[model samples]
Target chain A: MNDQNGLTIAVVGATGAVGQQIIETLMKRDFPYKKLVLLSSARSAGKKVNVGGNELIIQEARPESFDGIDIALFSAGGSVSMELAPEAAKRGAIVIDNTSAFRMDPDVPLVVPEVNEEDVRSHKGIIANPNCSTIQMVVALEPVRKKYGLKKIIVSTYQAVSGAGNAAIEELELETRALIDGKPYEPKVLPVKTGEKHYQIAFNAIPQIDKFEDNGYTFEELKMMNETKKIMHDSNLHVAATCVRLPIETGHSESIYFEIESDDVTADSIKELLKEAPGVVLQDDPANQVYPMPADCVGKKDVFVGRIRKDLDNNKGFHMWVVSDNLQKGAAWNTVQIAESLVNLGVVKKK
Target chain B: MNDQNGLTIAVVGATGAVGQQIIETLMKRDFPYKKLVLLSSARSAGKKVNVGGNELIIQEARPESFDGIDIALFSAGGSVSMELAPEAAKRGAIVIDNTSAFRMDPDVPLVVPEVNEEDVRSHKGIIANPNCSTIQMVVALEPVRKKYGLKKIIVSTYQAVSGAGNAAIEELELETRALIDGKPYEPKVLPVKTGEKHYQIAFNAIPQIDKFEDNGYTFEELKMMNETKKIMHDSNLHVAATCVRLPIETGHSESIYFEIESDDVTADSIKELLKEAPGVVLQDDPANQVYPMPADCVGKKDVFVGRIRKDLDNNKGFHMWVVSDNLQKGAAWNTVQIAESLVNLGVVKKK
Candidate 1:
């Protein structure tokens, strides 16, 4: 089927926030797809989604959906990916999953194209996209780490509500409007959608992003800490993260404090390296009041880096601000880039 | 004035946000004032401000305004404090300044009552209130630092717009409403009121809180870093801060990562220490999903601390979430507390 025209691409959970972005990104990139298949739950199976100029119907996602697909992008949920990703892989569809289902698996490779593009080749059957917050941080840090060698990372994220899903985005909008009109609202989707308690994210900051793990760290923070090690392939690198959900709807920003292995490396050298690094745009001109901000990075795909400064007390420590569209670069763009990398590396070819 | 019926209290910048809070705090605390005088700029003079059913006229803050006052709380601006604080002090009024003018002065003490109440006695007529971000953090860290022996601190703040002033509060509300209504708005105030470019703060985070310094850190960030050392009276303590302004209107939240000299300290032990600390509230219960949040901490005077967790990689490192009302504990309450400490310590006296 792939050889008849070109590669066949299937997008699982096509009606979700990230799944929608994946479809848009696939169209925007003009991916060489012989056929594009959209899959969702049975409830949304007949939904019509227009990609560029073509209208396609979303089919119910199942094992048979990947019968003739070459590459499948999954972003619905962890459970959905867990249930159907292997089935798609078994049907010879190279699955680039955007869920946490296979990210930490020993046999799976979690890839951030800018940081670990080569790791995509080693995937057994599934290639996982790193977490939204982790993807931008690693993209900004990879260049610095390659030149100076990273020793420690302490990050605090200012993430958007969109990372929670489209429902969370609606909640933010509705709550904000209600609050503006002097109406009371019962928050039912934030902090964690399925958690016991929900907190308001309208003009408020909730310190917990995902559910808390046994170690007292939220799952989002643990994902950043663990996935940084897995994606960077450096378990010895000390990483600590505090993930918080802000009221923003699109972009995710992070304040990262890192210690380099070399004490003599200055902030200027790190900025210079990031200036030319792939998928990174340096915006660090403090004198002119230039820096990366979430609002400005809403629609862009590049990881924006700025506010680079050496720690006043620690000669080896440096701090930076990194921002990127959580839906784009963090999820959709990275997934599409991974699929592109697979084709470019000849790891997946027309069948 | 000291030999009158009781202490004569004056609140400078009474028309301002923190100033109004100071007047309210004075009334709430029943500071035993013989007379209360509200002072503001000449433009705001003759305005009436009602505090606890007492209608006080706002007078122009001048040297003469403090002639009959025993203690004058100044929150107008740094320039106003710089000019009038010394004049008020010369007229025998103890000026408790809530600006950055005299905070770093070698002769003036920067005080957070919970952390450094005794330092109030060393003030040369003018006692400076620490920055809002610094006050809450020091309040949270003082107990742990005292018991565990502090070495290094790195903090990233989710500060409220009220810390920037009342104008910023209006801007947040305006921008939020405009965005909700799908109307266009040109941000005139945010990040900094007089910044080169204004950015939207509603549903977004601005990395640059104040103007950037020569070293690429914002002035707000520097204030937290420098004021912490001065208030703690430990110049050798390693401190780094990244101060950010969130969309919140009142409370300021901080993600603090600190390294203690004692490697044997556990997060549970730290929580126990803070549970009994002065002007501190312990809300850490991971099982119950309890933690400190900015929205929940508004109107509260205590510094709320929770999410205590020891670092996974470094035994000496610990992370916690600290939050407090920026106006109360950060400014108005702390200023009032300093005045109370002065009177209790016999540094100032009522008739």
Candidate 2:
């Protein structure tokens, strides 16, 4: 690693699912990090993890943990970010947050670098990663937005259980096998497990992803709406999201409908733009039945998009299917990418 | 049984998946019949099925098979329906075709008795059952549309693979298990297998249901668009559908966004109308985390609806989810319901 450019990176909540992926992504991308720090809660602290062939011991995340860290990646939770993210930022570390804590904050820049990489420069201290469902959709839609100009968006997601957490994914597999074997299993971690009730995700579709707000939108829906506007810098863009958790174990698939600003925009033209778009892999050969799938997107970072078509009557209306590994591009890779961007933009300094 | 009202009933394609459900639905509903006839291909002709504790042998379906039949319930493929449906109708028997053969025919009435009981009388000789995806959405939305006029409908379906027939369901289960086990299995029946290539449906989403039509919409999407207009008798109403085959086995789920003519409509008002509507089961209780799931609706005859919410900033727009067993309400039960409607309305006579 070059001493002049390499920086020390700290991964908060390294033992967690998304946190583990963040470490793997950083290693797979061969990010230029001079040193790496792994931090978790007190319970998970002292555990050891194997990342990119290196065995690293986890330590408890504290306010003083960011003393010499050049970049801190946070995916513990919203509470952890609210408590420690600012602390790490105040210590002169560029914080890349994968929680909802700073996503809606006016000062934080919610970024999907391909969609809003320039916004990263304007961030005061923290950079927020959009929701997993929103991340894939924006990646697919940004290319279309850039070429055609987006006016409105309506998205219905077929999200995997992994987006909820690792336990939800395990629950899906266990419950599915139980149902196959004619055994009854109670659902304890779906449709917001912390909420009063939980719904079964075995061959079911749950419409409420997060708790409903007073304005009638679920917290997850609000994240897509608000985070999308922030990342695209288009508060006036009309966006409606119906987030549903399916029985899938990993990856998230979304049926996105959008109205472009141009009248003569065709599905073929949008397909061409996405074919050349960054972080996007077009799998839309309907003749050969090649389209995106969550099962196929597991462990992948690129957003998979297909089924691009114009509406029958409305010339400006279009529909597309967006899919990506929720744990990868949605959370981990995006955080690691932010770290990479910090070095590339010379925003991080070694202590 | 009263011989005067009793009619000779024939179930076509009696050995197939939907055919078996149609026979069971008829026997369970105690359909009026002087004699029950089961007809299939020559391969399944001698097979005997127990219907309501009675053993009925399947006979080969031929044009003359409808000679003594007073009514015919056809679950055969579209090609068989095209060949045998009119032949039975010409033999003085009312033919209820479950295939897409006569669905879009101007002379044929597509009926979901609950949605359009009056439309049943307009059937000249052949009646059509709407697509499985369309049947559930219209059944849930028609009640609200009747009270308040409907202007536009946009539906994105999280459809079950069972709608593609029993073979696709088997493929999904097999492929899913193979997927989890890190094995390779050939996909033979998904996303229109015969039309082109096949993709694994386990933990994946395929946007193409039926083959691509002349327009960009898949055949399944086009069927929903045209069938809704025919069944509701609303040629002017705007309808758009994006059908995706999920890995689920039986029940089909749809996310429908519709605009009502009245501007003062509320979500509560729509729920009230659906609660009292026929063949509708309101499972919406977001406060207590009660909503409909496809796994729970298996073998059910009624349409299950939940997650009803009004669109923000648009008083006339509302969104709801509709789910039902595709083989039941979407096909067999609806076919028998039309048979019952014919008997109740004196559209068919046994002398």
Kindly list the per-residue Cα lDDT of model 2 for residues A198-260, writing each as its tens digit: 877876778889888765568898899888888888888988888888888888888888899
Compute DockQ for each candidate against the true complex. 0.85, 0.61
Off by over 4 Å in 1: A1-4, B1-4
lDDT at B218 for candidate 2? 88
lDDT of 1 by residue, B130-243 (tens): 889999999999998888889999999998999989999999999899988889989898877877888888888888887888889988899998999888889999999988
Estimate the TM-score of every prediction. Answer: 0.98, 0.97
Q: Pick the candidate with the highest lDDT.
A: 1
Cα error, residue B210 of model 1, in Å, equals 1.9
Model 2 bad stretches (over 4 Å)? A1-5, B1-5
Query: Candidate 1 DockQ category?
Result: high
TM-score of chain B only, all predictions?
Answer: 0.98, 0.97
Worst 10 residues of 1 chain A by lDDT: A1-10
